[model samples]
Each structure stands twice: as structure tokens, then as C-alpha cells.
Target chain A: MNNNQKLERGAEDIFGNWMQASMDFWNSMTGRHGGMFDPAGALAQAAQSSSDQAEKMWRSGNKMFQLWFSILGEPENLSSFAKGAEVLPGFMTQTVQQMWESFVEVHKQLLSRSTPLGQKAPASDFTQPDLNIFRTWKQIYQKEFQKFLNVPQLGLTRVYQERMQRFVDEANLFGTALAEFVRLFYVPIEKSLDIMQTKVEEMIEAGEFPEDPKELYLQWIKVLEGHYTTLLKSPQYTQVLNNMLQNLVKFRNARNELIYDALGNIPIPTNRDMDELYQEIYQLKKKVRELSRKLEAKSN
Target chain B: MNPPKIAVDLILKKLAEDTEKVRIRAQKASEVLLSPLNTDIATTPHDVVYQEDRIKLKHYKPAEVRYSTPLLVVYALINRETMLDLQPERSVVRTFLEHGLEVYMMDWGYPSRKDRYLTIDDHVNGYMDNVVDFIRARHQLPQINLMGICMGGSFSVMYAALHPEKIRNLIATVTPTNFDTDAGLLHVWTRDMDADTLVDSYGNMPGDIMNLGFLLLNPARLMIDKYMGFFENIDSKPFVENFIRMEKWIFDSPAVPGETFRQFIKDCYHQNLLIQSKMELDGKRVDLKNITMPLLNIYAKFDHLVPPRACELLTQKVGSQDVEDVCLETGHIGIYVSSKIQQQFAPKILDWLKARDGSAKTQAAGKKASGRRKSASKAKPAARSGAPATAS
Candidate 1:
């Protein structure tokens, strides 16, 4: 237990505490019993945690350098420099990769078990129509592949390249998860909102009072709540949710003809028809009198 | 100086004077020679019935006596009435003439500032009635034909309803009846216009402002493409001449009177009252049912200014049993000027009028005859009236 050892232990303790706090923040924000977290609050927490970790890491690294300088007598040494560079790169790489992997795995598990807060699927295992799902799926897959090409081979040495390659291979698994989230979770919720808005407008125009206006309003709110829940449970669901909402709006618009036809309040045609009918009755009466005159003449 | 030099100078001066005199004489001779050609070319055979506010009614001589009825041609106030008889080859007025129909067209001249107060009622009731009466009196006919173009078309429809007995045949070309529909940008903007503010500020709505609005409706195509097209075929003299003529016609817009502008927007655009049969011009109910005369509604299919939908509703709303809607494949201006219209549409209109020539007598007999007498008398009084004779 030298000073260097004390610093290293302190760094480990700080990292552990930060990771715990980060997890706790995420749990509170997404917890069922707890009120939904404001997006601003979540963003602030993420930024604070990342900054604290970087600060602690820097302080510990400086302390370690001081301790090593005291022990070595000479400041310039190839082995010391190489060790500093080599060990930290592997350590940091492992830490970040583990964090990302754990986050993704937890997200998947949560999505699988949880239903959106205000909405349930019509039936268990019920899925949205797969009309344009393939288009989005292809786009996501291509984007993920391009992201793979962009990942830096995090190595100044040959041995590090092997480590980097392993990380890249693991990152590729997120692609399928991203695509599934977009198709299944995000799209359906968005489409439902769009449909709800359209229905409300149509109802208003048709002059049909909603059975419960509050319930109609709640339906709209439920869509937004469902979107947030899906987004929290699986971040990749945002794109699909937007697509669904657009489709729902289109569907709602298509229902206007039905609503308008049922109302039957447009004034032009009914008036014209009435006029025509009146004219026909008048003509009929005139014809009857003419026929009676002809009969009278024949009888005479 | 040499004797020949002096003689040469004197001879040259004499030659110049002689050349001047001969040139003058030649000019006079050419004027004399071309005078009859110009008169024949310019003089539309249509007779002038009534003149007021620089607007003259040209009475059309019928080819045959069928129904003692008159057809009034309400040309758009924006252009010279000569467009109805643009040329013998392509004259809408001539077609009506050949069809043995009595036609009366309004020639709206360039209105000076003083003439700006002329309202819609003044044109419809005062001028239009007078022309109708003039025609009625000339042949002792009971009713007259009413043909309106563009703005005039809308005016004619209003007039026909207000004085329904006077109109034997109602022909409206490129007429806008429904202004609420988004069939054209003009309809959409005009539908919500505050016309009172515009009319009150400007006694007569400026023609340039109207022209600018029309240009903006299809800015890229109408403003740019048309000019570009002119430059492309500038070398051909006939093409250039026709292009200049069209350009001149397009720019020659008349100031719409204040009250007329206000009523047009209120009745036709804002309220969409005309097509709805809810409009009242001069306290008289403008009911389309009142327009029970034979209506030959002509509209252009590709008219960007007035869509077919706008004009098509007139046939549906009007009470006429013999309403015939002809949708010509042309633009707004093209209804009058397009070569295809000259070849097809103009002739068809004449034929339609020809078919209904005999039917007018029966229709007018069913309706009031006094309305016809009032309009017919207007035509006769211009000739009989001893006011300063205006150009008809």
C-alpha cells in the first residue's frame, strides 16, 4: 500500500460509484411507480456522469505518474511510456465496450417484458402490418454496416488490432436490434396517434358529438405516453413511431368521405331534386286535365 | 465653276423636290387604295345599337328569320370587341352571323378617369337592357340572345336572371360561377377578399393591378415562357404580328368600376352567391331559376384563371331545361384566340345557337314580353336620340 496503490484504488471506487449513480438515474427515470423523467433531466444526468468519470480518471492518472517518477529515479524510460500507453488503451476499450453491451442487453430485456404504459397490443403476439417494414429494415441494416466501416481500429500496436476487431464484431449485433425496434415498437405507436387526430377532426366536421370528448383527448395523450415508453425501453423505436404516426394520419383522412356522406347536410342537390319533383307533379296534373278534355270531346 | 457642275446641282435639287412631291402623291394614292381594304378589314358587320360610357353595342344581322330573337355578345371589358371578329378566318361574331342569328356585342372602349364610376348595375341594367330592347324593337322580337365572355360572362348571367324574359339564348364562355373551390389560385384568393377596401381606395380598380394579379397566377409560364416564345419565332413576320397583337390585347385592360368590383367580389367570390342563387344585384334577386332561357354554357377545360368546375356548376344551378355545357380544350385566353377554338369551338357555338333559333319564340311567349321591349328600345334610341353622337 504505497501512494500509487492508494490512487488506483480510489479511481476504482470512484468509477464504481459513478456507474451505480448512472444506473440509479436511469432506473428512476424509467420506473413504473416513479413519474416519467423529463428528457432534459436525463440528458443532464448523462452529461454530469460522463464528465465526473473523465475528471476522476485524469486526477488518478496524474497521481500515478508522480508515484512512478519517484520510484524510477529517471523520468525518461521507453518501458514506462509504452506501459502507460498500452495498459490504459486495453483497459479503457474493455470498459467502454462492456458498458455499451450491458446497456443494449438490458434495453432488450426490458422491451421484451414490458408493455407501453397506456396501451396494450390488441392481442398477445399481435404485430403491426408489415407493409413498409422491409424498406425501413433494409435502410437500418445498410446504415449499421456503414457505421461498422467507420469504427476506428483503436490500436498503435499489432496486438491491439486483434482486440479492436473483437469489439467491432460485437457491435454488429446491435444492427438487428435497431431494425426490429424501428419496425415493431416505434411505427405502431406513431400511426395510432395520427389515426386518433384524424378521427377527432372528422367527428367534429360531421357534427357527431363524441360519446366522451375527454376519452378522445385521453386517447391522443395515450399515444404520446406510449411513444415515450417505447423510446425509453428501446431508443431505436423513434423512427418506426414517426412512420406509424404518418400512416395513421392518412388512414384517418380516408375516413372523411364516410363521415361526410353519413351526415348528408350538403344543401345543393336536395333542393334541386325537390324542385324537379314539384315540376313533375305540376306537369302530371296538367296532363290529367288535357286527357279529361279529350275524353269529354269523344263522349260529346 | 464649270457650267455642267451648276446645271448638275440645279437638276439634283429639282429631282429632290420632285421626289418629295411624288412621294407625297404616292402616299396619298396608297391611302386611297388601302382605305377600302382597311375599312373592310376593320368594320365588323355587327350593327351599333346603344352607346354609353364609351361602350357600344354591335347588333348582329341574322342570316335567316327563325325566332324573332336577339343574341347579345358581352365581350370582356379588358380587350377591344374586335376580337369577336378578329379575322374573317377566325371570327366568333361571323359564325353567329352566318348561323342566321341576331347577335349584339358590347364594345367596352378605353375608359378615362371620369368613366370610373360606372357600376355593375349600370352595365347590366342600363346598357345591357338598352341593347336588349334595341334588338327587340328592331325586329319587334320578344327576347334577345345574351353571350358573355370572361367578366362579361358573369355579368350576363346576372343580367339574364334579373331580366330573364329578355334573354332568349344565354351563352357564357369561360365564366366563373363558383369561387370557393380551389380549382384555380384566383378562386382561392378571391374567395376571401375584402373588396370594399380595394374599391373604396381606388374608384376604379387599376387595370395594371388586375394584370399583375393575373400574371402572378401562372408567373413562370405566362410571363416568362410567352415572351421567350415570342423571341424564338421573331423572324417570321406573321408570327411576330400575331404575337404583338396578343400582347397588345393582354396589356389593354380597362379599369373595373368601383361598385362593379365590390359587387363581383362580394357576390361571386366572397359569398359564392351567384352559383348558390343567393346573389342580389341592385335589389333584384339573381335567381338562376329565373334564367330559364336556353343556355349554351361554354367553358375552357385548361383555363387556369377559371376552371371547368367553376363554370360547370352554372348548367347545374340554372333553371333552363335546354342547358348545354361545352368544355373546350383551351386555356383562359385561348377560348377566344387559340387556333383550335377558331377551328372547332367557335363553329360549335354558332351551331348550338342555330339549333335554338326557333325555340326562342316559344320560350319568350311563356315569359314576360315587356322586359324584351325595354331592352329593344335602348337599341333604337341611340339612333333616334339627339345627343352628341358617340362612336359605336
Candidate 2:
């Protein structure tokens, strides 16, 4: 075969191989090959498959590179090279479309599980969005993005990066805990509202609705108060509150660590430095008081 | 049987009347809001006699001192001492002063980041001891009356135990000595709290956070009904002023010293050591038997912060035979601020203090305590196990 013809064939083969590799990675990720929705397993499989496919693509790529160098050296075969590159955009579009479709499907699945008030729907066992919202987000975060943060760092900024990562993780955890805590507050409000609705409906049915609207408000508030009292004293509420507090403390400590590092660059003292000084001063004062008291006793 | 006929016209008329009333009220409220207001708190005149770091000794000397022994009032670190003298009509300090008693209050000024290391020992042994000694020396008396309010009362109990010779009478009002009962939400929630983590994260427990916690204790009443009451009477200048004053006092919280908070929660709430006489400070056990001075333990019956169950056990555990507990039908702050309850509370304290004032028995007790103080280099933990009181 002529040198130009050989170069064109090599270029086409490399494009085909690259497209196939991209399709295979996308397919594995979207579970089109019929496997459970295990992101970690899928990722491992995709990595292994891509490595094997990469070797073949690399060989073809090398041959194409050599052929292109030979053909392009004679300036007349450039149009053929340009023509072979036209397949790439279509493959890129297809991969993006598959990813979009998969995301939509996942979103639909998450949305299908529940009702807004966390009650079970008669039609299906789908949990509403508000129910376990944090858990859902946490699951996605741990599976998809947490590993990126867990990646080992290099060079002099390693400690700084690690501290940042810790702060970020703690902050996320605190946010989830706080969300749960806030959800408890809403529970009383929701239940009160539901009660109010039924009471009003009953009143309407009996034609005994109060003329004074303030009475209704007063009644509603009493209902709300009752619910809140029950909720505030509940073990579940206390557990959520403690969880939030603990998480908040962790977040604050993590944040303070980063601040400590940052403050090292500035002239201002950090809490740790000030705390040490305070401790010494406090001890010194205590000793002075003790000594003074003893001296007074002896003098008396 | 047929249902009662709906009166739509009556409902509409009532709604219109309510709207008109609201509009009129809003107009008057706007005028009230725009006008000058005297919402200032802690306005009772007093001089700062002694100062130690953030701690200050306030002397509220009456025109005529009825009692020989000056009463030193130690307030909690969680809030300002201003709650006693909230208003002219309902002032506890004024009542004490009018009854011809010498009053000294400890103003635990807002603690800063540096104050985080200050512990319960520092408060009781350091500041409180110095204040008591200063008062005793200034008044030329060997012993003074000691009264503590709420958390301050807890400190007073500790102080009276450690330095019984310096205290002729010990009055703990709305104070929490026992921590085993789950009668109050504070007792319940604090039992599980990681106070070390809280204090460590925020050097001194943030005042705003503490206030938020207090609000959570009764959000329905404090958060909702209280404000609703305000809107209902927004046009009344007097009501508005009092509401604002109370609001200022309630929200004006100070950061509790971190070490003190950690020790309190751990030693008292978690371990239930205070009433058990197992609580130790500055290497000395707070033996309740050492608190042999005339003890008057007063607590609010409806106090959600320091329930009666927490305070009632103190009189039983103490070494003094001359012990009395007055349980008032009031809430925590209500004991001080409620106009109706003020008559019962402050007068009751005055009478109790008066009855104990310079009694021969009290003097003998003080002398015995002085001997104990002179002989003992340190306090030994009490071995007697007192029966725990059930929550009412």
C-alpha cells in the first residue's frame, strides 16, 4: 500500500480504538452491562478494563504517530489526517449523553422513595426527599467524592492540605448533623399543623368554627407548644442534639487547626498560644493567693 | 340532630373588628417604639468596693444597717447579678436594703478567652473567699451572712463547707446541689453533654450558645408565648419597658469559664458528687458536714433550671440541725421578677437571716467551725451516705 493510504488506515484504527475505550468506561459506569450499582466495584472494573484497552490504543497510537510523521513530512497527506479526526466529536457527544441519562436515572430513583412528610405512600415504598436527605447526600458524597479528598498528598503543603481536608470533612458532617437536628424542630411544627388542619375541618363540619380568629391562633399555639414540649424531652431529640453538638465541636477544632496554621504567618497569637499563657498566669495567681493566705494566717 | 348553623356574617364582623383593633394597636405601638424608653436594667445604685480581675464586689449599703453581719450575695457566672434589682417595684436588692440589711453582691464580669482556665476552685476558694474575708475585715466581724443565687448558690454551699467559720448564715436560693434527678431539662441534657469538648472548642462556653440552650429548655413559652404577650400589650409603655428589661436580662449572658463548666458538669451532673460530699476542689473535699452554719436552702417549686429536688437535698445532707428549705410557688426567674412572689421570697430571706442573726447557737457553731478550720490543714471527704431524694 502507498504510504499515504497506510497513514489514513492507522489514523482510523486509533480513532476507533479510542472511541471504543471511552464507550466501555461509560458503559461500565452506567451499569449498562448488568451489575449492581456499586460505584467502587464499577470504578475498579473500569480502571482494569481501561488499562488493558489503553495498551492496545497506545500501540495503535504509536503506529499512527509514526505514519503521520512520515506522511506529513510530505505536506500533501494533511487533509486525510484531518478527515480521520472527525469521528472524535460524535464519540464525545455520545459519552456525555450517556452520563446525563445515568444521572437522570439515579435522581429519579432517589426521588421515587419517599413522601415529603416522611410518611409511607400507599402506592410505593419510596422515601420522600426530606426524609433521610442527608443520608442520601452522604452516600453519594462518600461513594463519589470522598476518595478524592482521601488521596495522599505530596510536597511541603501536605500538612496544610490534610488539615483542609479534615476541616472540610468535619464541616460536612456537622452540616448533616445540624440538618437532622433542625429536622426535629420541624417535626413538632408539622405535627401541629396537621392537628390544626384536622381540628379546623372538624369545626367546619360541626358548624362550630370560632368567630374570633385569635382563639384559633391560641389553640394552634397550644397544640404547637404541646408537640414541642414532647419533642424537646424525647430521647431521640436529645441524641440528635448531642450528635449535632459533638459534630460542631469537631468542626470547630478542625477549623481552629487550619486557623492556627494560617495565624503562624501573621503576628497575631492563636488560641493555643494564648491558652498556654493563660494557664501559666492562672497557676501563678493561685500560688500567690495560697502564699499570701499562709502569710496572713501566720501574722494573725 | 342537626348541626348548629354557621354564622358567616358574625365571623366576618368579628374579623373586621379584630383587624381594626390590630391597626389601632399597631399605631399606638409605633408611637411607643418611636418614643423614648427606660429599658435599662441593674439600675439600683451600688458602688464597686472590691475588684479582682473580672470579679467585682458590689456593696449595696442601706441608709440604716439593721443587721450587724453584712450579707454577701454571690450570683451565677452564667448571668449578670442584675436580675435581683430588675426594677424598682420588684427589686430583691431593694427589698433587702429596705429591710435594713447590708448587701454585697459579686458581679462576675463577662469572662474572656483568658478566663477559660478559671475553675470552680478559683471561683469558690479564690474570689469568693477573698470577698468574704474582705467583707469580714471591713465590717470588723468574724463572720458574715452568705447568700448565693442559682449557680452562685452552689458556689456558696461549697464556700460555706470549706470556710464555715467565715459564714454565720448560708442561704442558697434556687441552687442545684444534687444532680442525680432528671426533673429539669438542664439536668437531663447536661448529663450526656461532652462539656470538655464544648469548653475545648470554644474557650469559654459562648454566652449566645448558652442563651440558645436556655431558650430551648422552654421554647414554646420563652420563644412564642412571651413574644405573643408583648404584641398583645405593645401599646402599653410600662409593659413594653418591663418586657424589654426582662429580655435584656435574659439574653445578656456571659460565657461561663471553661474549666468551671467542665468541672461542674463532670463532678456534679455526671458524677453526682456534690450532695454525696465527694466533690473536691483545690485538693480539699467539700464535706457538707463542715457546712454547720445556719443553712436556709430556698428553691423555686416550678423552677425548671434548678428543680426543688436538686435543692431540697442540701438541707438534709448538711451537718447543721438549724436547716430550713422554703419552696416557693414560682419558676426560676419568677422568684425574683414576679411581683406577687417578691413579697414571699425576699421577706422570707430577710426573716430567716434575722432569726439567725447573732443567735448564741450560731455563735457557738461558728466557734466550733473556727476550731475545725484552725486544726484541719485540708478537708476530708465525708463518709456518711445520705439517702437520695426523689424528684417531685
Candidate 3:
């Protein structure tokens, strides 16, 4: 191997040994994982487990809605068939109304639950019934988010750890931006339910059925547009946007470092070298402008 | 007759009509995009008369010269100034020339990686001063008219202050002078930004990054609603052309020089130092009191980028007694490109300049080239290296 490869090998071994020894000490201290213990690590593991349980439990609540929907949707016994037929449509309408109310309640929670500046919203916030009304969607969103940032590679290798850490930070920023974007995108549709509910009731009272639901959808889009504008101009939106920008810069720097390392071995002038040349020429031009002005003054 | 059947039939008919309309619209949209329509903008004639590195000075000569004093236009570095000459009907340069005035504009040019070391001092004091001196000598006059746009206006204010005798009439359009304002979200966000880290990482502020920030400022209006409006108007030929022209202008952003971007954010924005006179260009303080010329401060009443409040404080802080502030009835870019404003904006400047036009008038008034001699009589043909004053 060449000197660079050897140096990297040396680094990997040293860092790998250090990490292994650190884990062993932590295990001995906490008396877990066969002498692999850090109370912080134990606590983190416990926290992760509990959070998984909570998210699963919270997501399962959708089954309750489904159960209620099915029970009311179909009668178990035929003895009450006449009443079932009479009450089914009204029950379905009421259920839809209740679902909308739940969504609005969740929206209020999202608006009210404020995180301190600089901290990401807790992961629990993502899995809440308020955020995820449907099962398995948040999980999919998170998986895709990771895929976008690239899969986390395993090992104590310096490059792997660095890339993983950078990607994790990027994922956090993307989560915030995507949440805000999706929220605004959902607002228009969520708002249609409200207008549709009202319009349906008015039609019933007037003894006329609303012919087109699409018209209500269009109106919802308009309402959503207005809310989206307000959200876009909000201070919170600006903060999130800045967070994304800063994270983007970090990601760019990481990529630059990796690319520069590879490019250093090649026989090509990099941006850094070009920048140096530019700095030199820029300074020279300034000097020339100053000198030219002086020469003109002297001639005069 | 069954009421349900009638309702169903009516709904289906309505849907069919809408579907047919949309299909026709989509067909037209495809054809428009596929077939190249004339997307021409900024077609007015001009020559690159002077060069300093990447910077170019363009002069647009008129068929008739009514005024003696030539006006120099300075545009902001954030975007190109092609918007001033967007089209035949809406060209600011053409309007000024038609009004019988000689016009020269400063093109900050596309700054590259080599431009990272270009400080604000280099632009305001060095290049601007050189250009001003060149113009003064060309006319063999003591002072000429100066007009600055957006950030360029801020630089002009600083330059005019340092060399007040060189400028007889000063026009500052849609420029931000006072940095302390909460009216714009950009102001609030920049106040807390770590500009040092940003400049260190990127060297130069990437235009794409800046454009993203701008889009986020009003995402619904700029990003979503704008495209939706375009979709609604996609079938209209004129609308499509205008939309593409605007899109071209919006995206043709240049990466700003690193040193200049860094100092602007730190001193002018984060520190709120410009209006306080705490800003130093090349170790010399930028005092607004020295801008005591016949000042015309033009600002857009509804400009979101540079709010009216951000610009209104200039006249209050300036030391000029003859300063007049005019609030135009449009946003920032619209003041130049809007059809209604195009008819009025250039003429307003023309009238203002004619009143104070006698300073550069010579025995050869109304001539193609005015009496010369303090320096070169004509704008020098640009050289390849962009070295300053090579034309002279």
C-alpha cells in the first residue's frame, strides 16, 4: 500500500481499538452487555425502546377508528336490520365530522407545542396521532428520509462515522422542512372537509343534495392557499428555512472534504488552487488600479 | 321522472365540459412549450465601453441628446440589470434615450472564484470612484448625475459621500440604507446569521443558495401560487412569454464576492452599522452627511425585499437640503418592468435631470459627443484583460 492508504489503515486500527476499549469500560461501569456499559448508553437504549413502544401504541389507535367504522358500518344481527339501515348514513356522516374534529385538534396541538430555538422537535412529535393520522406512513416517511441522506454504514471507521453523523444531522433538518411542507400541502384538503360538511348540512336543510363535491374541493384549495401564505410568512417558517440552509452548508462542506481528499491524489487544479490564483490576481488588479491612478496623477 | 337520474346526468355533463376544456388547454400548453416562441428581452443596443476585471461599463447613446450631463446607472450585484431593458415597451434604457439623455450603466458582472477577495471597499471606493472620475473627465465637467439601484444605491450613497463634488444629482432607487428594520423577515433572519462560518465554508455566497432563501421568504406566493397562476395561463401565448422572461431574470443570479458578502452581512446587517455611520470602507468611515447633492430618493411603496421603511430613513439621515423622496406605486422590480411605470419612471428622471442639466452644458450642446478633455473624450474600447482605464 502507498503512504496514504497505510496512514488511513493506521488511523482505522487506532480509532477502532479506542472505541472497543471505551465500550468495554462503559460496560464494566454499568454492568451490562457482558461488561459493556455506559449509563448514558443504557438510558439511551431504554429511551429508544420506550419510544418505540409509545409510537406503536399511538399508531394502533387508528384501529379503534376502523373498528368503530366497521361496527356501525355493518350490523352483526339481522333483528335490528331496519334500525341499522335507518341510522347508517347519519352515523357515517357523524363519524366523518368527528374525524375532521380530531384532525383540527391535532393541528392545534402542532401549533401550540413549541420547541426551544436550535433544538429539533422531539421524535415523539412525529409519531403523534396529531401528526400521523394513518398507520405506517410516518415509518415510510422516515425510511425514505434516511435513503435520501444515504444509508448509515456500520463500523468504527472514521469515514463511516463522519458520513453517518453528517447524514443524521441532514436528516433532522430535512424532517423539519418536510413536515412544514407537508402540513401546508395537507391544509387545503383538510379544509375541504370542513366546507363540505357545512355545505352538505345546508343542502339537507334546504331539501336539495349538493351535486358536485369537486366544487367544494376547489374552494378548499383557495382557503388552503390563504393559510399557506400566512405560514410561509411566519417567523417559524423563516427559522426552519434557515436551519435547512445551515444544514445544507454543513452537508456541502462534508462532501467537499471527501471530494478534495480524492482529488488531491489526481493531477488537476482544484477550486482551492483556483481560488488562490484568483486572490493573487484580484490583489494585483487592485494594486494596478491604484498604480494607474498614481501614474495618471503624476503625468498630469 | 326520477330526480336522482336527472341530478346524475347534470353532474356528468358538467364534468365532461370541464374535462374537454382542460384537454384543449393541455394540448395548447404542450405545443407552446415544444414550439419555440420568441422569448427575447433586453434587445436594446449598447456597447461595453469600459472594463475592470470582470466588470463592464455599458453606454447606451440616444438618437437625440437633450441634456448635457450624462447619467450613470448602478445596478445591484444580486441580479442582472437586464430587467431595465426587458422589452421594447418596457425598456428603461430605451425610454431614457428617447427622452434625449445619455445613459451609462455599471455591470457588476458575473463574479467567479477569483473574485472572493473583492471587498466592499474595492467596489465602492476603488471601482466606483474610478468610473466616476472617468465619466467626469470624459465630459470635462466637475460633476455628473449618478443613479444607483438596490444594493448599488447603497454603494452610490457611500461613494457620493466620500466624493461629493463629483456628483451633481443623485438618484437612489429601491435601495436599503437603514439596516435596523423588522418589516422584512430577511432583516430579522440576517441579524442572527453566522455569516463568518457561511463565507468561510462557501468562499463566495452561491447564487443558488441565495435564490432558495429568497424563495422561502414567500414560498406560497413565489413558489406555489406563481406556478399555479402560470398553469392557469399556460395556454396564453403572451403570458407564457412574459412568464419565461421573468423566470430567466429570476434564475440568472451571480455568486456574490465572498469578502463583500461577508462584510455586508456582518457590518451592515448583523451589526446595524451603516446607518449609524459605524461602517468603514478601507478604514474610512461611511458618513451619509456628505451626500448633500440634489438627491432624488425613489423607493417602491410595496417592495417586500427593501421595505419602504428601510428606504424612507435615508432622507431623514442625509445631510442634503434639496433631497426629494418619491414612493412609486409598485414593488421593487415592477417599478422598472411594469407597463404603467415604464411610461412614467424614465421621464421623471429626465425631467429631474433637465432642471439641473446646465453643469455639463458646453459650447457644443446637443452634439453627439460633448466637449471633452479632463481624460479620454470617448469610452475606451474594452481590452481582454479588463485592466482599468486602458481605453483612455
TM-score (2 decimals) of chain A in model 3: 0.40
For each prediction in turn, the share of the native Cα contacts (below 8 Å between chains A and B) that it retains comes to 0.00, 0.70, 0.39
- Tens-digit lDDT track of model 3 for A1-300: 999767655655564565456545644543343223222566768777665565455445544644444443342322244445769899778766765765665555555543332343231122223333222233333444345455455566767566656656555655555665466445433544555667667866665654565555555456545554555455654555565557667766766766676787899877877877887888788788789989998999
Winner on TM-score between 2 and 3 is 2
How well does candidate 2 reproduce the true complex, by DockQ?
0.51
Arranged by lDDT with the best first, the candidates are 2, 3, 1
User: Each candidate's lDDT (Cα)?
Assistant: 0.59, 0.79, 0.70
**Model 3: what is its DockQ?**
0.18
Give residue A37's lDDT in candidate 2 (0 to 100): 23
Candidate 1 residue lDDT tens string, A198-264: 7767865665534433466556555544443333333233344333333333333334333334345
Compare the candidates by TM-score and give the number of the best one: 2
DockQ, each predicted model: 0.00, 0.51, 0.18
* lDDT, model 2, position A16: 57
Highest-scoring model, lDDT = 2
Query: In terms of TM-score, how similar is model 1 to the real structure?
Result: 0.46
| B195-302: candidate 1 lDDT, tens digit per residue | 665654455677876776666444334544456455445444455445555555566677776667787778777788888888876677788888888777777666
Better of 2 and 3 by DockQ: 2
